[model samples]
Target: MDNFYLLLYLSVAMFIGSFVAGLVPLAFNMSEGRTRLLSTFGAGLLVGTALSVIVPEGVEALYIVHTEKYLPGAVQNKDRNQIISNSLIQPVASNLAAKINYPTYFGNSVVGKGVVEQMQQSPVMDKKETDEYRHSEASVNFNAINQSIGYSLVFGFLFMFLIDQISKYLSSKDGDRTHLKLTATVGLVVHAAADGVAFGSASATNRAGVQFIVFLAIMLHKAPAAFGLVSFLLVEGIERFRIRRHLIIFSVAAPVAAMVTYYLIVVVENDKSSTDSATGTLMLFSAGTFLYVATVHILPELLGSNVKDYQLVNSATEGSSRGYSESRASLKLIELISVIVGAISPIF
Candidate 1:
């Protein structure tokens, strides 16, 4: 409940910050290079959050879910054969096999490669192979869970990829690009809602810092998107009133989505273990989207600009070439360092 309140406060701050960013275009000029630099930093932050915080924590949460399910009152049940069989026993069998050269422990066995090969040639090899086929139930369960996580990650990535393709197709059409701008604005709003979902999922965890880190990354990216959206609209000769209307809608979208998502997760998950499992799945899914946005969308934009700068340097007269190249190198260095700093910030 307290986490929800914190989310509320963050949402309000997000709205205000986005609104202010939207208004920036009306007040002053913003340079292209500066915007890209800021975006580069935000992209790096996303990369770090997805890999360092979200993925690891998510895997941990899922492992806990399995532990709670399979090993309830593990200490009390340690001596019970049925209970021990349901728990993690593959590692134990393997260890015993390594130490004792044992072939079977109640149909659970681990054998050396040479032994397996020799058994393969014997008349009873078929029986041994059948026995080997059966593995610890807990191992199978963990394997299935890991596979589900991988699928979720891929699904999230592909979902974002489709969105990006649709957005690109819309913006690529020739002339009367008002619709292009509108499409882009919708995409940003959708991205914001996804950010809200990430925050909501993280908040379901016991770690407050995880939720806060996700929120920080969302804000870092959201501010630039808001500002860039308005700036683009103004350049397209959009009316101030219409632009404000769009900005308001964009600002409100995230907080609303966040509140609704958090409420739904809390209400639907009746138990701690279930809630943690759901949170883990969502976090991994969010990490995939974050990877898409950071690596596929934002970071690659630098390539085009870097090429343009290279051409400009090549075309410059000999007299100014050295100075221009030095300036460009310095700028590149700064952007690289900014990204590094942003990537490391969320970890601490």
Candidate 2:
């Protein structure tokens, strides 16, 4: 396909995918118990995605840091008069090396042994591609990806947390701590948010297929998340109109973020070396955002003591182990399992 047609189609597809995944669920009518189950599953997905995708990759990106600093110097030899030299650097898992520190099997891996040492020479095709310009380009793209994720996480979690605090404040002053309801209003379209970063990076990496995958994943999950929000709103005693409004706002935030990220990708690609500043800053922010989501948005609901007591009453105290209070606990269990399933499944 021609470039303009391809670009137009991709943009349209992305928008449609976001809407389908993120907006449709808000219109559904579902039980709080079911919503809880799905939400827990979603949480698990988030945790799993973060730890499995972002964290390990982030740590792996540390390999680039070593390469940029140490390997650049190490690649130098007295042989050729050329100022530039090339070497393949692989990411060695320090975490694994800590375990296999025996001298016999893993020769003095006190520091760390290379797990993916592509010690084999470079491919013929790579001989030309490994020149300064491509190196510089890849380096820049890597920095941008690092920064985009960092900033997204930071802003995302913090954005959610700030609203959570607002909800808490309102609940406290009204003598309704139990009613501190945050019904997926802050940044409910999580798939869109995730897709935004993925899309941007995919564009930079020229991985259009990867972007399509993200589009599909986001479409699959958004509806459930929106439904969860609606149920949460019911629990919080919100009016129907307000619930709809919340859903609309949450649904759209993701697309806007995605578009913004796309522009960022374009800009960052222009000059690769300038990525460190943005990437470093954004990464710190993402840490804060994830922490807030765990502590404020997800954890509080899961950790309620009354939920456990009610479930105990339902199951142990009587023949039936369900009650009004037990409802939350029951939902919490489903949520937990779903989360584990979504998060851990990806690892396998």
Candidate 3:
């Protein structure tokens, strides 16, 4: 199937999945234990996808771009010869003949031909010339492109951090949690757009299974995120209509961004190398954001103290210490296993 059509299908799936996930909070009262498990699992999926899929895929795409760009071929060999004849050998020989008053001797019609011929025939002259030239050219590009990738990753991470901090600040200042919820929702919407960019880039690559895997990883986390967002808004006493509006906005963000980004990338006619480079940069940036969301936003909630669990433990009978400790240990074990499984799932 065409990548455009494939992306369309995945975008629609994401839209519906997210919308339904948001509605889940309104439909059911989710248990604290179940919510934690889902969140932990989603965090693990983000970690697995970023480290195992997006980061490595981005690096490989760039590597392929440069490798193809610099590969020595018949055309490159011909160009190399012309460059050596016109630039390197001719300049030196012409100067030498002119200084010695032998213009005719080293002119284009005379010793210049002999000089070029001799250099071309020498075994050592062009033996590894193509390899060296390719290396030099590739090195400059690789360094610059690598820097771009690094900067993009850092930018993504910092962007999310700033969003998180702003939400926290607003939440601290306001007595009502509504503003904080809205701010956080905005952050998630932006992140959803970033995920769309990743999806679009993967589609641009036209690689089998690449876009599918990215879509799967995205949906896995996005569902839980959408659910959590609606739940938070509800807990903050936001009106049902307002919650629906937020859900709709969040649900549409990724699909619209995915279609727009994919169209922009696919419609513009550019060289394959440039497309690959762009795709790689976007993928790495998405990976960085994924890392931030997984580590800073999601995983910490699981690893840190739980107010619900603390309350439960406090309310337990004094004689239930052994059973309480054993149950706590079991819950910890379950959390660990869930995370490990989630982290490893993307590899398959």
- Top of the candidates by TM-score: 3
Estimate the TM-score of every prediction: 0.74, 0.51, 0.76
> Which 10 residues in a row give candidate 1 its minimum summed lDDT?
312-321
Better of 1 and 2 by TM-score: 1
On TM-score, the stronger of 1 and 3 is 3
lDDT of 3 by residue, 143-241 (tens): 977887798788878876666665556556766555566676776787788778878877777875878888887887788778777877787788999
lDDT of 1 by residue, 1-348 (tens): 788788889889889998998899889977767776787788889999998999998899899988776543233224435444533454455455456634443233334555443433322223344344333545677997899789878877887777766666666665546777677677777777877778778877857899789888988888887887787678778899999998898888888887777777776768888888888888888899888877766655454446334211111011111332233333378788878988988888
Please, what is the whole-model Cα lDDT of each candidate in the order they appear?
Answer: 0.71, 0.46, 0.71
| Clashing pairs counted in every model | 0, 16, 0
Clashes of 2: 16
How many backbone overlaps does candidate 3 show? 0
Q: Show where candidate 2 strays beyond 4 Å.
A: 1-28, 74-82, 85-160, 170-222, 228-246, 276-296, 299-336
Q: Which stretches of candidate 1 lie over 4 Å from their true place?
A: 72-135, 306-331
